[model samples]
Target: MTPDLAPQGALDRAWQRVADREAARLRDLFAAHPAPILPARAALARILAALILLGSAALTLLGLWLLLRALGLGGVSGGARVTSGLGAAPLLLFTWVARPRVPRVEGTPLPEAQAPQLHALVRRVGEAVGVTRPVHMVLSPDANAFMGLHGPRRTPVLGLGLALWYGLRPQERVALIAHELAHLKNGDPTRGGVVQAALNVLHQTVSVLWPDPVMEARAGLPEKLGNLILKGAALLPLGLIHLLLGLVGADQQAAEYRADLLAAQVAGSEAKAGLLDRLHMAHLLDSALHKQRHQPQRPDAFAEFRHMLDTLPPAQWAQVREEHARLRVRLDGSHPPTADRLRVVQAWPSEPLLTLSPEDAARLDAELQPFVAALEAAATEEYLYRTSG
Candidate 1:
């Protein structure tokens, strides 16, 4: 694409190589300095992200004002007004699509009264990680966990994936909590309003331009042609996304390693690395969960998840790692490659700073019992619907 007529697969193949190389480079950076400062490029990316957000907002407003002036005050002819409206329609649609949004965590909300034990563990992990406890608790069905600032008030919320929780050891569970809590301390600039808004704007633009295969099947010839043109138009936004990734990729990775460092500091580094390793095997859990649709009886999804992990062969584990090695991380992904993360945490090994004992973990499990079956049912239903009929 650099010469403007490059081979079709060249860019994708090259990027995969770049990803592999970049991960090793970042691994070396972590090995050399366990604690990292934000690079100058990341600072520049922040400014550009802010500009992109502001510029889009400004252009939308300006276009709207000019259109309204021509229509109402300029006393334009009916034909002229219609023409102007048609010309402004696409811009207006993009403005509406790309409006700033408050993204909410989609999960069952866990009140403090209902989940006192879980709340207590959250508080303890918060203290261990040197951050205030997140006020809201969420029970997600997926095999991932996150803690983030949400809403206008930026109230901290912790969402734990029940499936992932089922598979983790007690100390590894502590590591999961610590990792999320550490995002509050780590300098992940994506947490800021400007960057988040900018990302959302770009994401919405891409969504509008990307030709959905489901819809494409029903499209007429003219519509299909339009989709092709729109797909071509997508190149600019995609390039901007790549630019954003290039500038902030290493810097964002540094934040992740920093958070991993905190996790290692709180929960044993070995446990932290173990958690990352388990996370990489998430697809195996996903496959098993989806298979519940064909089960002879209603299966206990949590038990199935744990059993899958327990029974996985050594060769299967290596294959899983190899499969993940071939994958690439895009800008929108939550974390760097798991192998790179594992390397970072493994390099700085430590014993448990905050352990979750078997007894306490059992108590916490009891607190989650009511939500467990519901989450598993919901997750199984979702996986079945998504993967098949």
Candidate 2:
């Protein structure tokens, strides 16, 4: 691989342009068939992911052999023994530290006991979307709803960011819930175990192999030379991570569109589009919360933001939509562009399969009353909406 010497951001921008083109291609490709399972690419991603971890495991085996030989199990002695032992330690440590484990779900827990009505509301939406498993819920202070798998059982988890949750009307919350739950059935790439584990392995390996600039700055000539060697070594895995991202890019984009399709089926098409409109105004939501966070006297951040969102000028909506199309920034780097997602959501219409009433939503809110105060307000993030642009 050629080392271009461009900073990482420059590299990211270059690849991102490549990614944007791919997204556009996939958006068109999926129009006739919105969500194909993409078995071929999925297989390739799985194989690549497996090889990454297997490579680590092979290194760990080598470390074991060296350790065994150092202990005189193979009758090796003295300088050889000392050298083998020294080398064995780091390799063994690396494998242990980086071994795949189920990642913990973020945000504070909202156990079924603590929020049973809330849990029930999510389940109602889940069943309508065809997810049969028991659901767990959590609360965050962000402006997003999420679907994550938790524990060894891979129990489905639903996360509600109170800011976004409170901002939504009862029916809108049904659309939000349905949209997220649909990800489980829509072939979300991150939900796949083999490929996700491999991604985790690749990320861990890259972090270890990539030379730290801070360390390089403080190094002597000998250490700098070692870093140079490491910098070269890092290219293999770094390039692999990029390759995997490219492989999954189009499929993941399709998965999101497919999830929107399912959301429209579960919640009405108009409601789903309305939820997306709120997402497009995420920056405004952040601005409202930021204003409250800095106020000398405290205010109900959710109410302040909700009022602002409710009264947003029609021109501002048009402006954000224009900005989205012009800039091509994704909600997250992983998502298809917001403008495109909105276009697809509006184009494909469906009747609501189920609905959440205001009374039911109130019951759910009452169950989550304890978390309301803590989760309602969030501090501003420079990339808060940038992350979800």
TM-score of each: 0.86, 0.86
Please identify model 1 stretches exceeding 4 Å from their true place: 1-11, 74-90, 211-215, 290-299, 311-334
The whole-model lDDT of each prediction reads 0.78, 0.74
Give the per-residue lDDT of model 2 (tens digit) for 211-304.
7778888999999889888888778877887777666665666778888888888888888888888887766666666666676233566666
lDDT of 1 by residue, 215-309 (tens): 99999999999999999998877887777767777767777888898999999998998898898778766666755645723347776787888
lDDT of 1 at 217: 92
TM-score of structure candidate 1: 0.86
Output the TM-score of candidate 2.
0.86
lDDT of 1 at 286: 67
Q: Determine the C-alpha RMSD for candidate 2 after optimal superposition of all C-alphas.
A: 4.7
